[model samples]
Target: MFPTLLIVDDEQPILHSLEGLLSDEGFNVLTAPNGYECLKTIDAEHPDLVLLDIWMPGLDGIETLREIKKSHPGIPVIMISGHGTIDTAVTATKYGAFSFIEKPISIDKVIVAINNALNFRKLEEENIFLRTRMIAKNAIDGSSGPILALKQQIIAAAPTEAGILITGENGTGKELAARTIHQFSTHSESPLITVNCAAIPEALFESELFGHEKGAFEGATAKHIGRFELADGGTLFFNEIGDMNLANQGKLLQVIEEKRFCRLGGSRVLDVNVRIVAATNKDLRQEIEAGRFREDLYFRLNGVPLHMPPLRERLEDLPLLVERFTQSWCKSAESQPKSFTPEALETLANHDWPGNVRELKNLVERLLITVNKETIDLSDLPMPYRTPDVQVPADGLDELAGISDFKEAKAAFEREYIKRRLAECGNDVSATAKSLGVSKSHITKLIKP
Candidate 1:
């Protein structure tokens, strides 16, 4: 549908002229003779753009602008004034008006302003919609067994305004977990600010989390807004919290407990209503025992502890993960979708994944690029994963030498060799069995024990 425009003016002639001019320019125009009528029209029509006159009777332009902003902040309003002044333009701009145009209006200028305002409104609305979708996707995709259960628990606890401490190994999607909780929490509509505890220098960590007033330091030219202030009425995700210094941890605990903090070089205390979500790879309990972390701070942040399992423990989900990664990479590369052969898949399934899901994803991407085959086979597998002999121990014969019967000895060797090959190739049983000159099902049976 075409965008709608609202024209507000006390002069009937001006309003009539604007309605006709803008309508001819392909806008759905609504006309109002006074501020009250303009507001009423806005409530009813919900126009995309507004051409508001500054000298309207009853409510006047500034008051009307304020009301419009409060009711529909996303809609862009251009302030039109016959006796336009610098102060009037500044006030209108400050009250969220898109632009101020002086009267004795030009039809061309009016059209330009209307089009720009409407386009700006469209872009802003699109951005908000995209951000909302991203947050929703993160929340839904975060569900993976233990993580999913923890997410549900977080949703239940988030509304209560309790502090949260998320514990997991590096790259275990801890940040994603924090974001999911924040998005589902009572503060879902509010900001979710993040601060990297490990990235920030120790000396500046306190000032970054809690704002510093002007003159607080040599480079303090102006008062700074800190993460806590920015996250007011929302959530603050402190990533790598275990890396925070002992001194800063104490201050953080105090502010979290009191819900208030004073900026550096400032005597006045600023109150905040923010939910804290701290994430760390290290064990804070150990840090406390070592006297590197404050015990009190640990308890304060551990209100609702959540631990995410590493990717290795969830090996059953590898196939699903690989499919997802491959599809995503294909889309990004603008290439046709690729599939893995049974041998290729078995090769992947047998490996001990040290780097977890992240490593697997990287390997999949590498295979897609390096392997030219439409259906990746055993030879297409990377060097480290090509065969079992390289990674398997040479204690091979010694381990199988105990079997007395020839049939038993051969079967045992076959089982051990197939299993080792599968592990080296990432678990491609077909590829491993093929390399061993045996049927896939035979290798599968031998390795069943």
Candidate 2:
């Protein structure tokens, strides 16, 4: 694709001459007669580079450069002047001009400057793409049923202006999920402001969320920009939002529903276009039943629901999760990557992971730093995971690959053994248990749910 340049000058002859020269040099050229036309062209076309004249009618070059920096900060502008000076060039640079060129512009200098500006823009775009990609992958790693479902929900909800409620146990990566959604959303270009509702004091909840004007109350010495204003044109991640006090929930609901809010002790109503993504470990339904949470606010926030299952339920994915954590920790710590033995991985799967993925990641980090061994084994496992809770009769090492107490391994073996006996003697629970020399309840327990 050819690089597009917008040439802005009051002189029609210079504009036409430069346009033709740049077009001949394999470029798409656009011309604007003055600052007004320049700004309009920039808004409509979003050119790769701008050649702005210092002596334009109405808004001059320096003033125009400041506005450009404010609105389209990524686009580079080169300033041109008939009477260019060191001081004038310095002033233009301060206003965000990329380069300063004297009039009687040499096409050689113009070409060099334009090429540099375009290259910088291309590099900047590549950096953004790489950054967003890394943030998404590093934030969450999984391919379990629950994780797959959550990913699909993010893909569907990201493009819209819908609010999302993320519910899960503590340390289940709620904050990362919010960031992942924002990274893929239409609001990816803007910032994602997070508010920790549980940490904020009840007395300051309103000011913290909707800003506070000067002298709004005691200790209000200066005006403050709230989370909503800072997240304008972006995402507002309300971390632990269910913990916010009941009274403040109404105020938040009003502004969120209306898309407009007033600062404390201020008459002017400020507008914001922000997508809200709230997360909590608490069960909002139970809170509503107990009258501790407001139903109206819950309904407002839960436009789409995403639940992250606690890691125990997905024991099948433990080895993959552990491997990811170990690799990430080693890479960050500048050490050789560590490996886990089959028995060690099986040890992890057998235990109840009450802390979920976050706990497993922390454990991996701990093990990586403290244990210098290339391969971590079952013997290196923490105390509780070392027990042989599920004993295998005629067990081969491969079949028992470490997870025994998860019920499936032991239950499957027992159910098949009993079925073999029942087929020989005819299906009878009492007869099978007695013949197998086990209690009837024991035989009943082995039956698959």
Candidate 3:
């Protein structure tokens, strides 16, 4: 696309000359008679660059520049004036004008200014894109053994066309794992379409997945492309797939089994080349046994099982995660970088993290916004994560006294913690499980002894 330029001047001959000159130089030119007309044209057509004469009847170039800077500061504006003064030029520059050219305009100088401004905008856009991609990659950043293994597993599975089923607690980075795979795959350039099974209504399932033709159903005023077709030659991520009803499970199974599906109210068979990646926090085996999920669908979806360990289990990576979150958030907030005290980091690592990595990220952001100190201490942590008093009896350590390995010690500590929480919650299995950030099945196992 050619860069568009909007020229604003009260002189009719000047407008005609600039428009013709810029147009001949491969610019899409727009002419406005005065300041009001310039703003009106700007609102109607977002031109890449603007040229304004300082002397106007109603609103002059300086006033116009201020208004433009307030709303569309990204656009570059050049000031033109015949009665040019040092003060006038400085004021234009102060009001955010890109450059100044005298009334006797030099075509060469104008072209050079136009190219420089456009190139500047392009560089700014590229920086934003690179930063966004870096942040996405950092979403899965971890150095713990489990995370290392998970990364290696993703690297191996990404190149294949096989389906992936990711299981873990909520906020365990299941979606991030799927994205990591997509980024490393042959279809990395293609879209990674996502559908949250739990969020979609059961009534809209067919239309949502297969799309609908115009007048196919109520509110089908126009033809719609469903998730399946939209994800052609890409990836389809079914988040919380276990939440899908059994009836929908069978329909999805059919789609997976045969890559071809017909749109609703349409007979044409459309073939799609999409890789399926599913995630769930629920135990699908139990769901299958209970007849809430289909056994056949389970076998088909679990092509390469990937499980994300909860944050508590990967406590060794807390420091790295905290540092990354801090750097990322602080940069976004445009503030000086903040460091966490050793005591504070240790407190964060020791927590159960029921909400997992997401919970930690939220805490970091909260601290960044709320805490005024340069160094975050234990006191800066939320009340729940701060050092707890009198929760676990000293006698609890006796059972796991000889467990020297970090993993074994953590397991023992978690088991004992769950036991105390259960007693405190009055043996309410559900409440205890919720408080401790584990599933009921896990709590039951802890109470087996």
Candidate 4:
């Protein structure tokens, strides 16, 4: 679709000329004779770009520009004037005007300015889209009780400036939880700087946290901004924060308390304004007891503690999680959709997912890649995931043989299969449905209430 442009000027001749020229230049043009009409046109049409004369009678160009910015900040406006001055241009720019062109407006210059403004708006739109997608991708998936509670906690804590500490087993999505929190926080539009506490060497911890000036150390050729400085007005996430050494922990505590630190080899102290979010799989209480972690630091960082549940605790969500992974993998690979058989899902549900959701996602991707068929069966599962099929006793088989009708015999076998599966799964209806690759209602209907 062609971009729409609104031209606002007191002079009728200028509007008529520009409207014809812009229309011929492949634009949808809307004309307004003055500032009052311009604001009305904007309210009605929501044009992509506006060209307004600076010296209009009522509401004036500067006033109209201010109103436009207040109401629709995304729309770009270019100021036009017959008697332009540096002061006027600066004022227009201060009020968020995209560009300023003097009167006897050159059509070429107007078109160029219009194109640049539109491109800038397009880039801004794309950035908003990408950020939204990033947030969705990092969102924690599952409707289990534990997951719902975690989500509520995140929502409550995210808008505040308080510190957050996320604790969970490895691969339980600690980092993912941090990203989701930051994306929802007040500083969502700002940077989220991450520092892996366990990865940095002991000697360089201060330099890494408080930055370093040139000639600070042997390899410090130029000044370097540390994670704290980079995350100003945003967030600083520390991964494996429990692994930080005792010596560095003291320095960290002082900085957190003081909110100011001097860069290495620099005497001037820089004040920091950053929200802190840390995650660890280790139990901080145990570490503190062992004298490895500082008790004070733990209390400081644990303002709003959140725990991510391990996958085995939410087995009822497995089928949904599996389907989500399958769809994601299929879309990325540009391949045909794949699904797991009921028996295969049951086998997966039985396994103790020590590695949590991450492990399950990895296994799903591996299966989709290796299993060529659209329907992945239990036999396709690797040795560790597979389980023995239900076997019928000879007497039970004889009883089935007594049913002469094929439909009756089939129904008898299905009932027996579901009963044995249910027993094996400790009578979990959800697990039974997953294993059978059928709805829970289907399984419930076959079983005696």
Highest TM-score among the candidates is held by which one?
4
Going through the candidates in the order shown, the clash numbers are: 11, 0, 0, 3
| Tens digits of per-residue lDDT for model 3, 347-368 | 7877899999999999988877
Q: What is the C-alpha RMSD of each candidate to the true structure, in Å?
A: 10.2, 15.2, 16.1, 10.2
Task: List the global CA lDDT of all models.
Answer: 0.82, 0.85, 0.88, 0.90
The candidates, ranked best first by lDDT, are 4, 3, 2, 1
Give the range where candidate 3 is weakest over 10 consecutive residues by summed lDDT.
Answer: 387-396
Instruction: Provide the lDDT at 29 for model 1.
Output: 84
**Minimal lDDT window, size 10, model 4:** 387-396
- lDDT, candidate 3, equals 0.88
Cα lDDT of model 2 by residue, 139-232, tens digit: 6677888778778988899788888999999878898889888988898889999999999999988899989999999999999988899999
In candidate 4, position 96 carries an lDDT of 98
Which portions of model 4 miss their true places by more than 4 Å?
24-26, 34-46, 53-73, 79-109, 211-225, 387-449
Worst 10 residues of 1 by lDDT: 386-395
- Model 4 agreement with the true structure over 198-241: per-residue lDDT tens digits: 89999989888899999999999999898889998899999999
Error of 2 at 118 (Å): 1.3
Global fold similarity of model 4 (TM-score) = 0.75
Q: At residue 230, what lDDT does model 1 achieve?
A: 94
Candidate 4: give the clashing pairs. Answer: 81-103, 342-435, 342-437
